[model samples]
Target: MNIIALEALTFGLGRLAAASRKHGCSLTLFTRDKTVYDYELSLLDEQNIKVVEIDTFDDHAVVEMIRNEKDVVALLSSTDTWSLHCLDVSKSLGLPAQNADAVRIARDKYQLRNRLYEAGLSSAKSQLVDPRKFDNESVIKDISYPCIVKDTAGTGSQNVWIAYDKEDLLQTLDKAAQEVLRGQIAIEPFFSGTLYSLETLSWKGETRVIALTSRITSQEPYFREEAFSSPVTINHSISAALEVWIDNVLKSIGYGNGFAHTEFMITDTGFEVIEINPRLGGVQIGEALCQSLDINIYEAWIEMALNKRPALMDVPLNIHKGIGQLIIYATETGEFSHIEGLDRLSAHPGSPRFYPTAYSGKSISTIVDQRASIGILLAEGETSEVALLNVFAARNKIRVVMKG
Candidate 1:
């Protein structure tokens, strides 16, 4: 079997590539030529994963190359741009794939919010504003205070801003205009709650929740994720209600195939759908799920895409261990020096998994979103509390030193 992955340099890409090898499938990775390619080549070499350079998604030559690739069973991508490209190519080739409209709705925050409102799946009030017309008082009047301004199709929380009052909102709008934001931007009332994500696999509208994760984000007004703990077991009643809500949201959004990383805000009143990402949850969520569930989700996704069959993994009735993931970000702007407490962190009893993404001697600035992540740390323990504690301890022990 053969699978084609586009822009496949995500943190989980290595594991996915390993899984493909283990499953006796040949993997071909297609990525654009860029400076980042330098960092990716070594990882690809380490995995023995094949890499193909493409200037564009569907240039005649690239399409010809894709068509000639033998025994192509499925297409995989973790990034938004290439995932949509995969969908387009899948459509062109008459392969099983997600609907283009579904992918669009999943990627565009404004479309997602509008569709949810139209389908009565959403309760939050939101508006799509033209960045050029952001200065109009009439347009800004409708948006309530304590709202969030976000790019329509952005990922990793880029160009996201929180407004606590009208002054802040106006200032944020000015910033957006100066940034020359692309497409329409969304403004929605910010909800205060505990954030959670449902990692699900859907096949022809039949979806199964694979793992439930609880998230910790940087203290707002910047909402970059800081930590995550997976296979979270909520109370039975809450879990049942959330399951129903997630099912309705997924069905309403027209998610029929592949993985959907659905995020939600659970509060005392109820739950509100945040955004439905049409890819696997990035960072170490995949790693945590693999550890807690004892299954390779990427490999399962490949098999499901090719065979159109449900993936049945050997999930124990009770998952006793908790896997926690922490993303370490730069606290100050300066040249990168070195990380502290590597030896102590590694030798800790929890046996945490660590991978630093930043290079020494490279410059780093304050992290406002997921893109600024310097490194990732994972720790597993007997329970969620223990895992979280160990992860927190490890994170505190390991500090990213910035040169003066």
Candidate 2:
């Protein structure tokens, strides 16, 4: 089978490349020249993955290229910006795909919230404010205090802020307005609880949930993720309740064939949707899921693209050990000179897998969003606690040296 992957920035590129090689399938990657970094280009070169550059904004050009691929069996992308394009191209080429409108509903936070609210499903009370014309007095009266203000189309927690009072709320809006587009910013009454991710793979509207991951984020007000571990030990009833709720959400959105990564909170009131990403989790979450469950979701995704329901291996419900991913963010502002910790962490018993995004002489800053993340660390152990301990211990051993 021949598969064309759009937008190589997503972590899925490497995984998809591996899966293609394993399945004896050919893969081609399409990337926008301006958006992809030099290092990413080199990695694609080393992997012998073909890279084709085109203007992503040119819809006619994109459609022409998709139509030109003679033996293309599937068109896929794990990026938010290019998702609708991929789906539309696939639909034009007569391939199986999710509803374009449904995917938009999943990607747009305000739409998702309103849809859930209309359906009587649990969701945060949110209001949208025009960033350009946002007035504190009028907006404040509309929304409750202690709510979160976020860019309506923001991702990776780049433009998300929490406001505990009126002053904080005004300040947050002032900062967020500069980052978001002209559209309204979403302000929602905060829901407090433990956060978890529910991952699913769907085939023709039949959803099969594969993993339930427990997430740890930086302390209140910011949504920057610190770590994630899976096979989260939840009681059967709680798991069942969450799964049922997620299924209803997916059904309501008309989620068809593809992967859905939904993050929700287990609150005192009930389960509230955080965001429903219509793609695989970024970072090493996919890798963590593979390690924890011993199932290759990327391969399954490819198989599903070929109109075959992948026979996912039946992983035992009770996993003795936990598999986790820890992200290391830059703590200083300067040019990244070098790092001292890989050898130490590698030699340790943790069996860590490290992916360093910052190279020597690269500019670094205090991480406020996922883009500022400098590296990632992966570890596993006999228990969730043990796994987390190893991860933190290894992180403590490393020092990210920066040049002032």
lDDT of 1 by residue, 1-404 (tens): 78877675456666677777877888887777533444445667644567787865764555667788998877777777577777777777767677778888888888888788888877765787776675567667867778999888777767889998888887788788776454567898787888999988777777777778988888778888888887888899988887787778888878877788988888777888888889888777877777776766677666666674645433342575888888888887778787887877767757886777777776765578765677788898887668887888878778788877
Expressed as tens digits, the lDDT of each residue in 35-75 for candidate 2 is 34454455564555666788765667877886776687887
Error of 2 at 298 (Å): 0.8
Query: Least accurate stretch of 10 residues (summed lDDT) in model 2?
Result: 34-43
> Candidate 2, overall lDDT?
0.75
The alpha-carbon lDDT assigned to residue 276 of candidate 1 equals 88
Q: Can you give the lDDT of residue 218 in candidate 1? A: 80
Query: Per-residue lDDT for 239 in model 1?
Result: 85
RMSD (Å) per prediction: 2.6, 2.7
TM-score of each: 0.91, 0.90
Local distance difference test, candidate 1: 0.76
